[model samples]
Target: MRGVTELLRPVWRTLPWPSLGAGSAAGLLLAGMARLYPENFDPWLALNTLRTAALAFALGLAFLLDDPARHTTATVPVPRFVRQSLRLALVAPIAALWWTATVLLIPAELRPPVGATTLEAGAACALALAGSAAWIRRSQEPEPGVSVAAGLLTVAVLAALLLPDDWELLVAVGDPGWDAAHGRWGVLLGAAVGGWLISTREPART
Candidate 1:
């Protein structure tokens, strides 16, 4: 027990707790704001707003692996996967809870399709983390959050612009493309996880 705690201490210490806290607060604030006009609510509008919040929080979570002591930690006895998993394990619960709370904060009638919206969130968060991992694997920077977040946002914007109308990824519930959009989301989620796992492999020791 003590051994596990000791191993996780640095992971916890290195976590970007402030960013996580701020992101959660911002997300919930956006979620709560959805209640401001329930009578005037549109499901598509609510989804877009809530999605903004989720993306913001995911961007914050992307910073989980931004160890300021990356070089020093790499020299520690702990395996990279152990340390990375510890970082992820530490943040996972909070992320789940925050998502749940965000969903609840919006009035039920105004909420988007829960399953589909959650799928989009899952894909987005996975992409953010995977992008961070890829950046860490390729670059020597101790912190990759800024670049990761920027790139994530850029791709999101570009996709919104470039994707065909028939294949819209952010389709309204019950729209013809809704189910298809989620299928794409599933593919994205799988790809992101695969990339993260492959990139996160402990780099060949020097």
Candidate 2:
């Protein structure tokens, strides 16, 4: 436990705070826009706005694994997963608070169901992290954030444009497909988390 505690400060310094802060701010702004014209807000608008906000934040999270000192740290006594986990542990509370504030930005009477929207956000954030983890696993890039962020954005755009209705993951509330869509989201979240864990494994010494 003391070892873990000792890692906290250095790990905190290594976080991609700029991107994370930008993403959090962008998400909050987008969600808060719904409040600008409270009378114009409706369930559908609320849902899509929140979704966009979530995506914005997830884009920032895509940079979570970025480290200019990645190669240098690879030689450290501590394991990569422990370092990574420390980074996450530090950010988790901030993320929770950001999400809470974002949700509260929408008027309660017109807000979409929190549980479902939160699932979508969670899935998106997991996908971003998984992408970064996979990149680290497959390549030697010291900072993969740019490519990962671009890829994340591309995936989101393609998913929005290409995913067919039957397989849709972003259905509106009250739609016949809402429940099924969330089920798929649950699967996606699970897969992303699994992929992250698997990718965190250091390559076997050649």
Candidate 3:
């Protein structure tokens, strides 16, 4: 009701619409690629997208939750942790809807294995929650050089994603398609670390 609406107001105001739009576009492009290049319709692609979105959502939520400016008014009293947890909870159903819609749009043959889909979604949610919690805990007393490190890490992650795919490297190591799988997880972990560093460095003041 009113309480729920009020709690979400700040999150809505600070929502990263640009990033979200970019992600949605990227997802559509990937899906279209699968359709156009049926021969290259690998399940790994879907897994990568799922994991990346999961991680990104988690990082975004952490940033939004930890922003002190969101709680400028003292009139409303609400625990930060409670608000963050509720936001995380809301992402699940939305994710499910996204998954359903994505499936309906893609060719039947391009659909990912159900188990893999479930695993990736679960990993995304778990990593995001863990990242947000870590960020909140660290925000209590942050160190001086952490922000720089976080910025560097973020750049590194982008670089990794932009690198050309190496099938030979993937197979030589018996990784098969794990590069996409593990890479997404690595990005999530890096994002979590960055969020933790940022959250720890800034003191919460209302």
Candidate 4:
């Protein structure tokens, strides 16, 4: 308990607030577009707007692990896993609230299936965190956020443009392929979380 409390202040200080704030603002703005013409609400536009908002926030999450003091803190008594977990712990609730707000910004009648859309958002966030963790594991860079964000953007674009029809992940709510698409989202969420856990482990000491 004491140990955790001691680590809290430093961990809080290290968070990437700028990126997170920008991402959240961008997402909210996009989601708010759904309310622009309350009488003309379109379900399809609401769904895509939410999707874009999720991606925007996920791009910000790509910076979650960034710490300019990484090298300095490497020798701390607390394990890297604990520190990283703490960071996630601190941010998770805020992210959840942000998502909820984003969803509620649209008219209920125009909103997509909450469960499916939430799954997609969760998967996107997991992928971003996984990429950040992987980059940290493989490099000595103290701040890898920019590179990770760029990589995430590139992957998103490629996935949208190049993925074949049978493996579609961004299908419409009522499409016959919707169920299968979310199944794929489940698989992706699992894989991304597994990768993040593996990458978060402390590197073996020589």
Which lDDT values do the candidates have, in the order given? Answer: 0.86, 0.90, 0.49, 0.91
Estimate the TM-score of every prediction.
Answer: 0.94, 0.97, 0.54, 0.97
Evaluate residue 33 in candidate 4 and report its C-alpha lDDT on the 0 to 100 scale.
76
lDDT of 2 at 67: 92
Q: Which residue runs does candidate 3 get wrong by more than 4 Å?
A: 1-5, 42-68, 71-75, 140-206
Cα lDDT, model 4, residue 166: 100
Which digits, one per residue and each the tens of the lDDT, describe model 1 over residues 30-142?
Answer: 98887876776678778888898888898787787898889987877766666777888989999999999999988888888888889999899999889999899888998
Give the clashing residue pairs of candidate 1, or none.
none
Candidate 2 on 1-206: residue-level lDDT in tens? Answer: 67677778877898999999999999999988888888888889899999999999999999999999998888877787887877777888999999999999999987899999999999999999889989998999978888988998998899989999989887878999999999999999999999999988877888
For all the candidates, what are their Cα RMSDs to the real structure?
1.6, 1.0, 7.4, 1.1
Q: Compose the digit string of candidate 4's lDDT tens values, residues 14-66.
A: 89999999999999998887788766657877898899999999999999999
Candidate 3: TM-score? 0.54
Candidate 3 has an lDDT of 0.49
Ranking by lDDT: 4, 2, 1, 3
Cα lDDT for residue 68, candidate 4: 92
Please provide, for model 3 over 1-206, each residue's C-alpha lDDT reduced to its tens digit, 9 standing for 90 to 100. Answer: 47666877666554444544454555556555656776765655644554454444433333334344543632356555455555555554665676565554556765655454545444444444455456456554222123432443374376556656642111112256655655564565567655544533434659
- Residue 125: error of model 2 in Å? 0.5
